[model samples]
Target: MAIKIYGSFRSPFVMAVALAVYEKEQEFELLMMNIKSPEYMNNFNPFGKIPSYQDEDITLFESRAIMRYVATKFEGQGAPLLGSTFSEQALCNQWLEVNGHSFTPAIVEMAFSKADTESSKLAFEKFEKVLDVYEARLSVSKYLAGDSYTLADLAHTPLFHIFMAVSDDEKKKCLTSRPHLHAWIQDISSRPAWKKVTERPENTFYKPRTESQ
Candidate 1:
């Protein structure tokens, strides 16, 4: 059977996994499941998450783990996503952890929290600090993990896409004001695989809400 991904594009985690598959020159069938159902919980994810992956070899949950598996399984197929050197690999893993722990929380909070609220203000502050770290790191390197685009960079594309779509210009200045972070976002978001993800019909939900809208 073809690699099957049980989730919807409504979850950026799911899209990130799909992007990883594409980067590895692989294709998968996107499926949906009642995450709370016993069958899904028992066979796929005990935690009941939207994205669950199954292939001939393994069944998996957690988007980052799935992406890591895809990258390793297809290491020789397409873009070298694990980085070229030992140091780069180490940095790749480090930044992947950063993406998970440091970056994701703040962005999610900022995206979902209502504007002009204390919670929103706190989220923005935290997110700005994280972006400051990225700007400093990206200013000297071409990609997050190193010179090559690694899973670290790939992990961020979907989140940034969602953020850009939902944020107003005033809010977006948090990203745009940081020249390096803005440039890195442009570079990663422009990838053909990401373009393919965006073009999928299932990805119709996160349209940018501009001032006019």
Candidate 2:
């Protein structure tokens, strides 16, 4: 059976999974459904969240887990997303955790919080601290897991795309002010796999706001 993904492309989590599949040189059918429906909840994701994945051997939810599976299952086809060495692999896993726990939460806050509110202020502060750590780490390493591209780097591309699209010039300084972090974002966002994900017609939901509109 062919691979199938259930979710809206507007979700960064869904897009992240798509990016991973493309990086592995695999194609999938993108499906949409009522996630809260009993059939979907019971079969795909019990939590009623988006971005569930299915293939011949398994049904899986959670974008990160699905991404790891794609990387492993198609290990020889396209981009080597698992990192080249033992140490690099370990680092890749570590950074993947950091992306979920540290980076993602802060970016989500910054993306959704109302401007000038205490919550927005706090989110920016938290985001800047996380970026400080990223700047320090990326200053020396070419990618999050090391010198090579890995799932660690792939996971952040979609989130950053959304964040960059929604954020204004001032808010963008959180990334642009940090040279290493800025450069890293530019590099990862430029990959063909990611470009493919962004170019899909379904990706039209998160467009940047123009002054006139």
Candidate 3:
């Protein structure tokens, strides 16, 4: 059987996993799991999360871990996740953690608020602070892991993609206010594999560009 990615497009975490698989020249069967179902909770993710990866070698949860595993297991096939030098690898790990801890939450909160789910100004303020840190770090390096594109950079792609599509102003905020962050997002978003993902038939939840209408 092919590699199975259990989740839906609604979950950016799952989309990140799908991005990684394609970046590495591999395809996966995206299986949406009923997060409430016993089978999903028992066999895929104990946390009952949307994204759970399963392959012949192992079963995994946690998007970051799964991305790391895929990169190492299939290192030479696609974009290097570990980095070229020891310091680069360290920086990669640093940014990946930063992505998980600092970026994801704020982005999620802000997006939900944009949808009128609840208040999110506090989340937006928090995200601005997080972007400050990113701006500082990215000022020097071309990519998150110094000169190379790593899983670190790949990890944050999907969330920003969705966020940008929702609002042109938000897209401008995410990409332009900070010089390096903007460049990095553009670079990753332009990749062919990622383009393929956005084009998939099953991907129904599209937030169109403001100019589309």
Per-prediction TM-score: 0.96, 0.96, 0.91
lDDT score for residue 84 of model 1:
98
Clashing pairs in 2: none
Winner on lDDT (2 vs 3): 2
What lDDT does the true structure give each of the candidates?
Answer: 0.91, 0.91, 0.83
RMSD of 3: 2.4
Error of 3 at 89 (Å): 1.3
lDDT of 2 by residue, 124-189 (tens): 898999999999999999999998999999999888888787777877877888999999999999
Predicted candidate 3 versus true structure: per-residue lDDT over 37-128, tens digit per residue: 89888888878887899999899999999998898889899777689999989988998998898788887777667543336667677788
Candidate 1 C-alpha lDDT tens digits along 11-111: 99999999999998888899998999999999999999978999999999999899889999999998889999999999999999999999999898877
Where model 2 places Cα greater than 4 Å from the true spot, the runs are: 208-213
Worst-scoring 10-residue span by lDDT in model 3: 114-123
The better candidate by TM-score, 1 or 3, is 1
| RMSD, one per candidate, in order | 1.8, 2.1, 2.4
